[model samples]
Target: MAHVVSAMASETSPEDLTDLSLEQLLNLEVISASRLGQKSSQAPTSVSILTANDIRTFGWRTLAEALNSMRGLFTSNDRNYSYLGIRGFMRGGDYNSRILLMIDGQRMNENIYDGGYIAQEFMLDMDLVERIEYIPGSGSSIYGANAFLGMINVVTKQGKAIDGSQLAGEIGTFDTYKGRVSYGKTLKNGTDLLFSASHYDTAGVENLYFPGYDSPETNNGIAHKMDDERADRLFGKIKFEELTLSGGYVDRGRHVPTAAFDGIFNDPLFFTDDKQFFSNLKYEKALNENTSLLLKGFYQGYDYYGDQAYIVNDARVINHDEASGRWWGGEAQLTTHPFEGHRLIAGLEYQYDQRQRLLNYDLDPYLPYLESHRNGHRVEVYLQDDIQLLDDLVFSAGARLDYHHMLKNLQLNPRVGLIWSPLTNTQFKLLYSSTFRAPNAWERDYNAFGFVDNPLMREEQIKSYEAIAEWRSDSNLRLLGTLFYNDISQLLEGHLTGDADGNYALINAGRFHAYGGELEAEKRWSNGRLLKASYTYSLLTNENRHGAWANASPQNLFKLHYAEPLFDNYLSLGLESIFIDSRKNGLGGKVNGYELVNINLSSDKLIHGLDTSFGIYNVFDSHYQMLGVSENIDVLRMNGREFRLKFQLTF
Candidate 1:
């Protein structure tokens, strides 16, 4: 889809990207993909950015929707939760603990479950986001933990960008209603602040049917009047010179429609709740022309609650499960350019988990099943360097060491990369990296109702090697290619084992290997008209038979986005499409391919200050399914066609 760049953006403008020379385009600065800020052409890894203009033009409400448009990535929704599948590794029951999610360089993954929310439940509203950067590959070398598959970095808008107060509203299909109020101010003293609050609600999917539970005991596999969702969000930020403060909070609830975990089907009483609060203060100082220092302190709290209805003791009853956590951390970093063609960056971080707790009980009979509480802490240090041997050759390397109370040994991760600009319009890169994910509170302590716990479980490890090439022609055309090989070992998986308390325990099951490549091409015009397409091919295998489920990720993925300006930039129209190929499922069956198409129209000044957008999703209403397990419902069906209309006004 087409996107309109605003004056407040810090990224390279569409005009510059389309009309500028190759040498000028190579000077754009970017962060997140590499902790050290560097030019886009020199960044060690592959990076993709989606700006606020794109978000508005595409009419995307959730991060998941925006991610679907990104290359080498896709998400599968089972009506209960959405899981990110990266480069052909989509585990069925995972909580997206493999991908690290960050808001302004701060980690968002919780300690209790090692989970990151990317759906409507995400902490901040989409309107407050300035840009989203997707970094594909292992990242633990600098982040220290939970950066296995990929990483997502979200940058928020500055107060000067908003300028004043704004109001927005939207009413869409499925009775979805949303409203927001925001204010921003920038004083003459170089102080700026932004505050916003939003509310959203929807009566999602009134009824649905499942064929897996077609017995009289489970309401004949039908779910009715049980799909509803709502959320309230608050966010604020302030900055003055070298000091900055930011905080955010969110509370979300969703009604279960799939009757998962053997819960009663068609019941309206099954639901889940998520709440989070985070605050941080940061300071920075430039000691000299080529050296700087940064310090930050942060606090975070989280709570998760769930209620499921079940047939217990020949009666309808409820199972209540809850978890809450709190933690505080601090970090210090220093950067120096001590000599010519040499730059070095170093950092140290410490985090203390104040409280990690989980509880399971019965609401109908007033009984307690399990209660677990634990405290943990972590320490980490890292260093990275960049060297420019020649005008056309560059080398980068980094490593990190981490120590955790629950982990028996210290973990060390490392990364190395090389970049060569053979021609003014062509660049090549080679990279190698290692990352890991440690066991979380649930995996280490909670054996609540039926699952077993193995405290001896270790961290999961990954090693990756990749080669990339990017080329640009004089006609404003771009071509890019990337190939990678990933080896995953010491994977934590829950298997049916004859343990004393239950039948399932988490252990280091086996090894998995994957190799894939992505190809993309794009053409752009001086008028902001864009046409882009990409294709992906992957072949994934494993050392053991049980790891076949990881192949749920599509073997072939095709994506296209096109847009054209009409009526002298007053109106815009765009189209998007995605095609996925069949994949081998865990049950020895093959899941068929599906294609989705979307169209949208928007006008910026049709009514002067009133921006309007209309869109249609899933135009063909194709039905596709994803892999599932016993604890979660399979035979799940995706959403059909839907319509959206939105309006926003600024003062």
Candidate 2:
């Protein structure tokens, strides 16, 4: 499968791009890199793209699975939630707050936690995605906040892409099952509409063993039927001419088996439920060949509920936790060519957080521990210009000024990039950028029995520098290499204070530094053959602390992906392999690293109006462990081999 669509045109729709030639796909335009439609090679930062074709061929079940195949990116799951790791910067307990996630240019991060959901909790089903654009490095100059490391943009398929009604069903190992129904079409009056709904359920691992709870009373370190998960999602979109409306909703529930947060082991009462919803309205128009205008508004809401069973005074007690968040925002952007050699982009953005609520208490006794409600707003303005300094050189510069209500302060972020293309097929870039992440409400105002609030916490800041080189051949072969350095300050870390209560608080810790390098190569053949490989090396450390900051970040990562047509175009096969170096866990113990291989066989032409696929994940059944997020849990064992069979019918 071809991972990147080089045939994408600047203003063309996804359905139109499919009809273009391979050469056009090689120059595919990316929007997440600079909020503008520009070729990936010409973008201000390093970018990677994946299309729906790749997802179908690889049998990717979730967004995280698709993203994990990219260079310098990985994900870990504790059987409850998934976390994203980028270039050795993933920290234990962090809720993926540093990376920004957008769906069709609408921010999806909630107001309270600022977390990007990538697992089953994600709003859109994988089948609904048209393409995903990943831009690495500091992106605050264009995006206000939560773009500390990188950003992701998910583009949904248009109604015309589906062109009809569809039904899909899947059955996987461990009693997992899923079903989806969708309808889409383009009306004769130029109106486009699409709607989809899906439901998923999994019994999960039957006998999950936790070494920390080995007593007989705790099921001898084994948890039975405690890792179950269920999710439901709905998405809809409509478009007419230049105006578009879209919305999505997801509700997910997962059972915990690790006894996290001091929960009772082998108890079925430990579970978390998450729900998110968003609606977006957008308008776009081209004033002329050299000018374009865009305006958008969005509303988002999030809710979380959790129950943890604990032993209080030798009796079983249940603790209830809940949070609710709601927010609305708007943006106006203009892109124009001020002169022959310059392209300028300017935008204004505003957001109002209407509600931020957190509640925690004990059941049965009706004892309250914490209750808080707060609201805030933010405003930002940014400008970026790309100038053709010379025939073979391009200079890009941008900056943003933001006013945050919580901080009561103004922040300025800047970015610069210089690209030199000495040869038509070769280019080199030097880039520098700075970004920040504001402390969320959960980290600032949630004071509870086991946690304390820090209202005066400072925002985390980072500066990144990168040098990149890329080369592409006419035969659809590409090679890329990059070296990067990141310096971070005032990082927020949850630590136990010296107080007698043993309460944990979020504090602005000392500085951290990371340096890394990445190398990648990809080649594609016209006969449905592709090969891609990437390697990453990183060294991360804390300047103020002596111990290793190896939360979940690995030092070395290697990935490979291959796809080929089989049986004279009747079937397609995909193979993927990944290797991660060993890393130290949160408890100062080393977690052994392991490799994983996955295979998938798929075909869309085997039957009329039907698509079939079979996938085997973790083919080797490597017993790996990922760092745990809770203080009571040191490491969480990962899943073994699993199989899935799926079929889709279109009418």
Candidate 3:
């Protein structure tokens, strides 16, 4: 398989420069790095791209799984929610508010929590993905907000790519089942349309034990039948001429087993429901060969509902949490290359948050504790210029200004980078960037889960400096290396306040400094073998509290992936592994280090238009404790082993 792909890549037309030096070939083409579509080799940051082929070959069931295999990035799961940790920077109470997730250049973060879900709760199913591009760095100068640490762009498969109806089904560990239905086509009038819907459910673990709830009446720290999950999703897209319309909907339900927040044990009253609906329209026109104009508009709606059984003085107090948000935004961009030495891209963006609502109540007693609704707006503009200073050097510089009602000052973020291509298939880069995250409505004024409101919360800021190098050797090998330093200020943290049973208050009183580096290597052989390996080393310390910051994820992470074909392309085997170092837990003790191994076997062309796959996760059934949020100071024991078998048919 590897050799086949390489042969196709090597078989390009000579007029297209396939036999020329790779550097000169790249020089003739440009990349959409940072949304400017500049030179690929001269992009101002480190990027990793994976296509649908890679996703299928690895049997990746979710986006989080694919991301965890990458260097300098990983995710944590407490069974209730999943959080993304990057560059040793995800704190105990953080909600993934610093990263930006986009589907075809449209934002996916909710308005209230501002979290970018990466697990089953993630918006799009893995089967619909065409490619995923991950750009790691501070990108506020180009994306405005929530692009603090990195950006993930998910591109869906076009209608022409599918060109027919498809059905896929799977049965997995813990009584899990999934099914998908899809249809796509290109009409005779040059119209393209695609649609897909998926349904999933799992019985989850039968029982879980938590040390915090150990007691005679509590079944000795065990909760029975408390873990279950279900979800439904739909997505569609239409493209005609220069216009495109796309939308999606996701609804998820997850049951909690840890009995967090002093909730009753072994009860059915602990669950959360997350729902989202979004749509976007885009149009582009080229005025001339050197100039283009584009416009986009989007609408998003979100709702969250949670039910928990709380024991207040031994009384059964049922808390019903509800929230909603409605947002609409528009953008205009102009790209031009007026002269030979320079290319420029500029854009203006505005968003109106028409409604943000939050309310919580005691359902049995019919008591309302808090209710708030707000309306706000934001405006931003940015410009970036890529200049060819010399034959071998490229310089890039940009800045963005944002205006928001809650902001004390207009935020201005700047980014600058220098790329040096001193030799063929080799590049070095130096980059400096700044980014900030605006306080959300919940962070500003909402009271829930023993958390008090702080309407005057300030924005958080980050500054970073990084160096990177890349080389593509002649012997079918690629190497990447990166080193970075980050300084953060005015971090929004939940502070304990008031009397003995004090409520958690939102405050901007935390600070941190971190440094990290990562190295990765890859090889593809003509004998149909592939290999990838990566290692990351990092250290993070809190300047305000004088302790390790977000140390739950390993500071030292190593990963490997190897794949090969067997039995004349009728079967393929993939092996994967990850090793992580020990880290501190919330209760002042060390969580042990652990390793995981996963294997997959897939068959293509076993029969006409039919494919199959079998996978085993946690091959050794290694047991580990997953850390928790600070406010909910309870660790969740993860599942031991899991297996899945899937089949697909196309007619």
Name the top lDDT candidate: 2
Q: What is the C-alpha lDDT of each candidate?
A: 0.78, 0.83, 0.77
TM-score of each: 0.93, 0.96, 0.93
Ranking, TM-score, top scorer first: 2, 1, 3
Considering only N, C-alpha and C atoms within 3 Å, which residue pairs clash in candidate 2? Answer: 6-24, 6-25, 6-26, 7-24, 7-25
Angstrom error at residue 357, model 2: 0.3
lDDT of 3 at 466: 88
How would you encode candidate 2's per-residue C-alpha lDDT over 386-433 as one tens digit per residue?
889999899988888888776757889889889899998888988888
> What does each candidate score in C-alpha RMSD?
3.7, 2.7, 4.5
Candidate 1 per-residue lDDT, tens place, 207-295, comes to 66678767786677777767788989999999899888989999999988777777777778889999988898888778999988888
Off by over 4 Å in 2: 1-7, 10-13, 16-23, 32-37, 139-141, 546-549, 629-632
Local error of candidate 1 at 147, Å? 0.9
Per-residue CA lDDT of candidate 3, range 1-651, in tens? 000000012344222221233333333222252342344455777766655666777788998888878777877787887877787767544567788888877888888877788888888988888766676764323576788777777777777666688899999999999999888888999898989999999999877777666788778777778888998999999989888898999999999887666677767889999999889888877889988877888899999999998788778889988889999998888878889978787888888988889888999889898798988888988888888898889888888889876677899988888889898678898888887889887788777668888877888888988899998877667788999888888988878987477888989987888788989887765554668899998787888767555557468889898978898878888888987677677567666667878898888679987779999988999886568543333455578889989998766
The clash tally of candidate 3 reads: 0
